[model samples]
Target chain A: MDLDSQEQILKLSELHGPSQLMVIIGAPDPEAAEITAETVVQGDPSYAGVLAGAQLGLDVYHVLDESISSEVPPEVWDAQIGVMGDVLEADALVAAVAGMRQPGSDSS
Target chain B: MLEGRYVIALGERDGISGPAIAACAEAAGAKVVFVATECFV
Candidate 1:
């Protein structure tokens, strides 16, 4: 994640607490999604930005994740994400980020 | 389930994009605090 984005997330976490915050990622691939999810939930794995070693433990989800997509209306999902969902590795992308949320998930 | 939740949307510039994700989150009643469309590669 960029430094500015990390800063914003940190500020928001401080202001509202991590429990009230959710980070939604829409990266096209599984690897990218996992990395982004890690940055928010665990810390910045790359250790190159403000999130480095900062374990915010924030709630994170992929846009295509069933838990999140299911909450969105069908028509709105179709309009916003359905196109890329058809082309991308939707299942993998969803699982990759979902794995980050659980302790024993096997996304690898 | 997202009702009244605060959201930070990070989207791929080439795929979903930030604004699009933000719109979807809003539809689900999330209060989006930030949106950033970035290149992952």
Candidate 2:
């Protein structure tokens, strides 16, 4: 996550608590998705931003995740995200972030 | 199933951009508080 985004997340967490906030990631690849998920749940792995060592443990999900996609309107999904689904490894991206959400999973 | 939730959208510039993710969140009735699209690599 970028510094600004990390800061915003920190502020939001402080203001509302981690349980009250959710993060949606739209990364194209599994690696990117995992990294962002790690940032919100375990803290920034790169240790270069405000989220470094934060360990907010906030709920995070990929935009393509079934739970999220199922809720999105088909028309909006087709218009804003349909094309990317054809070009990216949607399953891997979903699993990468999903792994981070599981308790005691060796994502780190 | 994100109705009444607070959301922060982070997306890759080349794929699902921040605004696009924000739209999806809004469609689900989540209140999107921030959006940032950046290059991952």
Top TM-score hit: 2
Q: For residues B1-41, what per-residue lDDT tens digits would candidate 2 score against the true structure?
A: 57888888998897789999999989988899889999845
Q: Evaluated with lDDT, which candidate comes out highest?
A: 2
Candidate 2 chain B superposition, TM-score: 0.86
lDDT of 2 by residue, A1-108 (tens): 789999998998888776667888999878889999999999999999988998888888889888898888899889889878878888998899988985642221
DockQ of each: 0.59, 0.60
Query: What are the per-residue Cα lDDT tens digits for candidate 1 across A21-85?
Result: 88899898789899999998888898888889988888888888877888899899998887788
How many clashes does the backbone of model 2 have?
0
Off by over 4 Å in 1: A102-108
Chain A vs. true chain A, TM-score per model, equals: 0.88, 0.89
Number of backbone-clashing residue pairs for each candidate, in the order shown: 0, 0
Docking class of 2: medium
Model 2 residue A44 distance off true place after TM-score fit, in angstroms: 1.0
Worst 10 residues of 1 chain B by lDDT: B32-41
TM-score of each: 0.91, 0.92
CAPRI-wise, candidate 1 is medium
